[model samples]
Target: MNVLLVGCGRMGGAMARGWNGAHRVLVFDPMAAELPDGAERVDSLDAVEVEGELAVVLAVKPQVFPSIGETLRPLAAQGALFVSIMAGITLTGLGDALGSGRVVRTMPNTPAAIGQGITAAVAGRDVRMGDLATVNGLLEPTGQVVWIDDEAQIDAVTAVSGSGPAYFFRFTEALAKAGAQAGLPPALSMQLARATFTGAAALAGADPAELAELRRQVTSPGGTTAAGIAEMDLNHAIDVIVQAVVDAAAARSRELAG
Candidate 1:
C-alpha cells in the first residue's frame, strides 16, 4: 500500500512506525527531525511524486490545517483518499477544503504514540465501504479501531476516549495522595497506587464479564472494598462526576469545531 503522510509528528510518527516496511510512505514535513520506515521524505508537497493512488493522511494539528489545506488540496484533487487524525476538524470541513467528500475523520488519543491507543472514526457520506478498510489498515498500527455511522457521536467519543487518559491519570494521582494522607509513606503510597491501577486495568482487559459484574466479584458484601465503593458512589456521585466531565469535554469539542 502507498501512503502520503503529511506531518510526521507524534501521532503521524507513530502511524509511520506502524507502517514501516509494510507500506511505502511519501512524507511531507519541513520540520520533521527523522523520517519513518520506508518513507521517501520530501520538504514540500510539490516534491511528492508517486504513481498510484495514495492515502493522504492529515496528521497535523487542526489549527494549522487551514493553510495546510491550500497546499493539500492538490493531493485530494489528485484523487487520493483523505484520512485525518486531527481533532476538532469535522468531515464536512475537510471535504469542503479538499473538494472531495471521501474523507475519514478520526480522534486518536496521545497513547497512540505507544500503539496502545484506541481511535474512534467516522466517514463522510461520500466515502465508500471499501475505503474504510484502508483507513482501518492505516490506523491498525496505533491500536484498536471502532467505527460510528452518525458523525455527531464522534464528539461523544472525543469526550470519553479521546480525553479519557488524562482523567485516569488524575484519579490515580488523587488515589495516591489519599493513601499518603491515610498514614502511608509518600513513596509507598504512590507505588501502591500505580501498581493497583496497572493491575486492575490489565485484569479488566482480560475479563470477559461486564465491568459492573467484575466490580461485584471483587467487592465482598461486608468488606473494606464495599466501604470504599459506598463512599465513591454516595448519592450516585461517581456517575454524576463522570457525566459532568464528559459533558464538559464534548461541549469544548463542539466549540472548537466552530
Candidate 2:
C-alpha cells in the first residue's frame, strides 16, 4: 500500500519504519531525519506529488493541524484513506477537513516507537469494511489494534491507554524513590522498579486471569504486598485518583476536539 505519512516524529517515524520496505511511504516533515530506504521524505506538504487514492497517515502534532488543514483537503478529496494517530482530533473534525468520511482516528501511545504500543481506532460512519481492514493492517505493525464500536469511547481509550504509559512510568518512579528511601542503592532501586513493571505487564498480557486476581496471588494474606495495598487503597484513594485523572483527560479531549 502507498501511504502518505504527515509528521515523522516518534509515532510517525515508527509507523514509517514499520512500512518502509513493505510499501511505498511518503513522509512530510521538516524535522524528520534518517528515514529507511524505499521511503520518500519532503519538508512541506505542498511538495507531495503522489496522485490517486492513497492511505494517508495523519501524525502531525495537534497544534500544527489548524495551520495546515487546508493543504490536506485536496488529498482527502482524492479518496485517500485518512488514518490519523493524533490525539484530540475527532473523526467528525477530520472528516470536515478532509471532505471525506473515510477517516480513521487512532490513539497510539509512546510504546509504539518500539512496536509494543496498543492503538485504538474509530472510523467515521461512511467508512466501509475494506477501509477498516486497510487501516487495521496499516496500524497493526506498530502494535495491537483495537477497533472501537462507538466514537464516544475514544476519549476513554485516550485516557486509559493513550495517557496510560506516563502513569505507569510515574508509578515506577515513585516505587524507585520509595525503595531508595528504604536504603536500597539508587540504581538497584530503579532496576528493580523497572524490571518489576515490565515483568508484571508481560504477565498481565499472557495470563487470562483478572488483573485483580493476579494481584491477589502476589499479595498473600497480611503480607508485605497486602500492607502496601492497604496503604494505597486507604479510603479507596488510589481508585479515586485514577478516576479523577481519567475523567480530567477525557474532558480535555472533548474540549480540544471541539
Candidate 3:
C-alpha cells in the first residue's frame, strides 16, 4: 500500500513510523522539521504521484484542511481511500471537501504516540467494505480500531477516549495533591500516585474480570479502599462529575464540527 500522509506532526509522525517498511509513505508537511525513517517527504502535493493502491491519510489540523483539501481531489479521483484522524472533522465534511465519499473519519487519542491508543472510526455513506478493511489495516499499527455505524456517535467518542487521557492525568494530579495534604512529601506523593494509577491500568488491561468485580476484589468490608470509595461515591459525586465532564466535552466537539 502507498500512503500519502498529509501532516508529519506527532500523530502523523507516529503513523509514518508504524507504516515504515510495510508500505511506501510520502509525507507533505511544510512545518515538519524531520520525518521518520522509510517515509519520503514531498515538497508539494503537486509532486506526489503513486502508481498502485493508495490511501491518503489526513493527519493535518482541521483548520489546515480547508486550504489544502481541494488540492487532494485529484487523488480522490484516482480512487484513493481517505482516512482522517482529525478530531471533529465529520465524514460528510470530508466528502464535501474532497469530492469523494470513500472517506473514513477517525478519532485517535494521545496514547497513540506510544502505540497503546484506541481509535473510533465511522465511514462515509459510499464507502465499501473493502475500503473499510483497508482502513482497519492502516490503523491497526497505532492500536485498536473500532468501527461505529452512526457518525453522530463520534462526538461521544471524541469526548470519551479522545479526551480521556487528560482526565486520567488530572485525577492522578489530584490524587497526588491529596496524598501530600495527608502528610506525605509532595514529590513522593506524586511518584506513588503515578505508579499506582499506571499499575492499575496495566492490571485492568491484563485481567479479564469485570471492572465492578475487580473493585469488589479490592474492597473487603470496612477496608480502607472501601472507605475511600464510599467517600468518593457520597451523594453520587464522582458519577455526577464524570457525567458532566463527558457531556461538556461532547457538546464542545459538536460545536467544533459545526
Candidate with maximal TM-score: 3
Model 2 clash pairs? none
Q: What is the per-residue lDDT of model 2 for residues 99-165, given as tens digits with 9 covering 90 to 100?
A: 8898889988889888999999888867878898888788877889998889898889989999999
lDDT, model 1: 0.89
| Candidate 1 per-residue lDDT over residues 38-115, each given as its tens digit | 788877887666787688999888888898787777777877899999888999899988889989999988888889
> Clash pairs of candidate 3?
none
Task: Estimate the TM-score of every prediction.
Answer: 0.96, 0.93, 0.98
Model 3 spans > 4 angstroms off: none
Cα lDDT for residue 69, model 3? 90
- Writing each residue's lDDT as its tens digit, candidate 3 over 39-89 gives 998999988898999999999889999999989999999988899999878
Between the candidate structures 2 and 3, which one is better when assessed by TM-score? 3
RMSD of each: 1.2, 1.7, 0.9
Lowest lDDT 10-residue stretch of candidate 1: 45-54
Q: Is candidate 1 or candidate 3 better by TM-score?
A: 3
**Candidates, ranked, TM-score:** 3, 1, 2
